[model samples]
Target chain A: MDARPTGFSRVTAPQFDPVVRLRDFTRSFGDNTIISGLDLDIAPGEFVILLGRSGSGKTTLLRTLAGLDPTPGQNVIVPASRAVVFQDARLLPWKKVWRNVALGLRQGDVRQRAEDALREVGLGHRLDAWPLTLSGGEAQRVALARALVREPSLLLLDEPFAALDALTRLRMHELVLSLWTRHRPAVMMVTHDVDEAIALADRVVLLDHGRIVLQERIEAPRGERGQVARALRSRLLGALGGQVLEGPSPAEIIALHAGGLA
Target chain B: MAISHRISASLGSARWLSPLLFLLAWEAGSRSGLIPERTLAAPSKVLSTLLDMAVSGELADNLWVSFLRIVIGLAIGVTVGAVLALVAGLSRQGEVAVDPLMQIKRTIPTLALTPLFIVWFGIGETPKIALIAFASIFPVYLNLYSGIRGVDLRLLEGARSFGLSCAEQILHVILPGALPSLLVGLRYSLSVAILVLVVAEQINASAGLGYLINNARDFMRTDIIVVCLMIYAVLGLAADALVRAIENRALVWRPSIVAQ
Candidate 1:
């Protein structure tokens, strides 16, 4: 394990192998290079957040990692089993909520597994509901259930909560954190929200012009995030080319956290 | 304002009222020797003739023959059109190979090919059914091809990320996404099938409503002719209603329909 700089302790669990490794990966579209010679690694059960401005190729990188892009790349080793939860819930409108969760599974009591997954996400009551009839947060929770039911080795989320309302987003953050802790799948989420990255990620990587410009490992304990959050916020804002403020107060964090857990 | 509201309320009910009034006027005109019953039979006379045909089983037999021809023709047309649409929609090679030829075929009105079909197939059931099938195929192909082509790329990407196979993607995503348009095609093709059936049966047929109509024209049996025409109108309405029912059930997930 790599040592952290002064005042920041390393919190990564030892003995875990890297689930995703990319070396010298390059992609371009018709002479306009998007991602060039990028290298990244995500350890098993690690939660990494990718932050970038618009057009920084964050979604492009996520898609490439999900194996959705057809273009050939160099030295990319993604897990054989992976799932993605998109910014839009992307549930098939034609399928019922339970069937959407059961999608891509071919064996072993798919309905039971889907029910269990939806129940985990607090959507057991929405098994037969239509996706269009669901609230934005409910739909996202169902999407989370769908991704998790596959029991993937790697989970990719592209701004999954960006469309949600503030209270719902807070709830979703807690839901995602709880689900991540329970499932222990390696996760890489892309987002534009700095506070979200600070709140959720084990490591936060900043991308600019398709290349990683800064990386920071968040070392604070899950429930004890207030102590180091301010210092971390300033550093992240500086990396993102923005001046730092005092940041959200400890009371706000507690209130948000309490509301989310409710 | 209240008087205006009352007037509008009555106007709304006038949809059915106007048709009833027209029937009443026709009956009165025919009974008073004004409409000239030889030229056009009264509604009551047409109804009586229809009852006579039904009692003799002649209406049932002719209607059965027409129904069988439509079913066979529509079955062939729908199957061929759907297969072609899928082939053309799924691949660039298929689009290039099949689309241009279909475009050319669409422009050559299938009704105009009746004479050519008669010469080729020789006044048999084959020619009549083939003509109906030809007329039905274009609408199904046009609508289905566009429908399949218009499937959202985002949904396809989402399916691909889940590692769905090509066949599975088509079955689950493409087919369901294209269903609304496919239903539209079905309705359009059904109407075309009936229209072509009318023409094909009129051109030459041993048994059908069209044959009954033609035979009545020779004897100046306007009442029988009116009865056959009424049957054709009823068949068209029934076909439309059937498609609407399927659409309501199949697209129940649609927000617009659900709100209704």
Candidate 2:
């Protein structure tokens, strides 16, 4: 109950074209409030990761922004075109890869557009494969293809890699970054993994009890292994009540792989 | 896939072994006079009777009449069931208005209404086909209602988040999701239609398989009666197999050996 917020600044006029603007957003279920009087903004093409515990309401905020849930009155402003990639990579099992990616596209040449998106996600050869036959990673990749094919100005990802193995999760982080770089959509990813927050986010916001407790802008670039990223990870973890990792740090893992390769 | 194909081929030859043995034992019993021909005709006699009827065109004529009844009955049943299911499945008001009535209809077995139908529509093809159609509605309605309601809420949410219109969601997400169940319903309804057809024809009929069976009953032609029963069995099996074939084609997207 005594979590501290360090190196935190309430974001203001952060960058261009604020695709997301939340003003005094409060959501309650019966007597319990999940999010309370929250204000946040995401600049155009920014990658922001929200980190929290299981009931932290990180996903609730994401769903609201994706228009899957109703906003509290008109306090939320999101672009009409937004897509979400859920934790389970919710592909329709009855649909083929291309058909899933082409689910809601209103334009002609949808198949070709889906194919192009799949090609970008390295799933061009799996256009006709059923979602049930796809491996977990491949299915998520198809989900990514489905989201990106919409050409949304904002992309919401709700722990989309939580189900994958460690290796696949790492590869997905890279794939997601490359896609983000190419498409330049305002991305808000929710995760409990602090290292993942540091690995991909331009800014990391830790939510505890449905309110932003810490909003640390990662001055270090994406994939940076410098001291600031490590400091932010530790601070963010400590702010969430001293969460400690039981595994090797990202640096040691990288060094071990580097030594093995050389 | 190759291994499964070979295994099924071997199993296919073994499939006839039981029926073949049964026919052989029947032939033996009939030859020894241990089995009374009047009580139950031998398999050979039933086969010969079927051929004789086929040659005289009497079997075909009756079969055509029965087939028309079944097809027309099923067509009516499927349309009504699907429409009612959609009305109940898609909207809250529709479900309130339609689902309870269908549920009550489901509880009342269609055969129980035969006397009423006869009194209402008379002892003609209209009443007979009406009975078949009534029998066909429940199976289609029950499976499809469950199917439509059982559509994953997650998929609908996904579709909505991806900007699919409500109608688009039904077309792209709901219908395809419910199709496997709809086909299952159709299979049940087909069997029900045949059953109702048999019962309706037996009550009062001038032509069709039931009439033929009734005529044979008068003269104790067990061979002809056996032939009619076998034809019904074959038709039931064919309807089931046809549904399976449709499933294999339409549901090939499922990750299973049979679907593939």
Candidate 3:
């Protein structure tokens, strides 16, 4: 088994077996090249938040990781089990809240697991409610619960909370953090909000022009929202220039951990 | 506001009352020599004719035959149409092969096909039932095809992400998404079934409301013809009501659509 960095010892940067390794990944729709010669590696149990403006291919990269979108033949060895939560709740309107949560569970005590997921997301009271009757925040939470209940090796979130109000978004952020703490699945979330990326991720990877521009470690505690906001704004704008920040690739950012670099 | 409410209530009640008043006026006109009795029989005379037919078991027999034809035709039409529609909806090849034929069939009025049907199948229940089924199938097919096509692509994407196979995707996602449209098609086909049955029965039916009406027309029994017309109207209303009830039960998840 590969030596895993855990707890405070994780400061040495875990020698992760790349769960999703995208090599020279190029995707195009018609003439528009969404991603070109992009290389990315996502480690298991690592919270990697992808940050970019709209059409910068953050969501596309996440979809590729989720195996939702078609890819070229070379991008094989993708994970078998994946769960995706779309920007919209995308709840089956015909199903109740609990059934929507247990959507992929198939059978056998799915009710207990579904309720537990709903409770984790603070939606236990709304288990039997009609999906159409749910608020935007509630609906998105249900979407998250559906994804989490799959117990997937990879959880891809494509702007899952972009529609919520500020307070709801904060609450969702905490719910996700607590859930991540418990399950420790490989999570790759795409968000336009830079602060959201910094607040939730262990390492924030900035994507611009379909390539990794900068990846900075957020070594601060998860609750330091203001510091995260500042760090994110700095790195996020730095990536937008599409020039190498300090002239290093993504591997260098991971390597920086051993060199006592922040 | 209260006065307006009262006026609206009165107007609502007038739906039933207006037709009743018209019937009473017709009876009075016939009694008072406003028109000749043979040409325009009173409503009383129509009711008595209907009651006599009912007692002689003629009306009941005709109703039974008409009911049987409608049921059998509907069962055959809806089953074939829905299955074909699902196939056409799901597969591009099925749609390509079947859609154009459905379009052509929809335009060819069933009444115009009666002579051809009689020649092909003889003046038996086969011709009548086939005509009804033919008339009914197109509406169901068209609505179902459109419904399946119009299902939200996002929902399918969500299911795919969960690793649902093609068959499971269709069963768990596509069918439910297309159900509302399929129900609309069901209602349309039911209406078409009864309309086609009446026309099919007009030619060489031993007993049916259509036959009764045809015989009454030949004898100039205007009273009996009116009775048959009433029965036909009632049948249409009853069939529509039954379809609506089924639709409501099936689509219990859907919120009630309050009409303005």
**Candidate number of the best TM-score:** 1
Docking class of 3: medium
**Highest DockQ among the candidates is held by which one?**
2
Superposed by TM-score, candidate 1 places the C-alpha of residue A137 at a distance from the truth, in angstroms, of: 0.8
Give the poorly placed runs of model 2, Cα more than 4 Å off. Answer: A1-16, A243-248, A252-262, B1-21, B257-260
Off by over 4 Å in 3: A1-15, A241-262, B1-13
Q: How many backbone overlaps does candidate 2 show?
A: 0
Q: In what order do the candidates fall by TM-score, top score first? A: 1, 2, 3
Question: Could you tell which candidate, 2 or 3, scores higher by lDDT?
Answer: 2
Tell me the TM-score of each prediction against the true structure: 0.93, 0.90, 0.88
Off by over 4 Å in 1: A1-16, A71-73, A246-251, A258-262, B1-13, B256-260
Ranking by lDDT: 1, 2, 3
Model 2 chain B lowest lDDT segment of ten = B251-260
lDDT of 3 by residue, A1-262 (tens): 1232211222334455566777678888899998888877778888999988788898888878878777645443456777888999899888888988877677779999999999988998999998888899999889888888888778888998888887778777877878887888888899987657766788888888888878887776665444345445655776675333442233332222222211
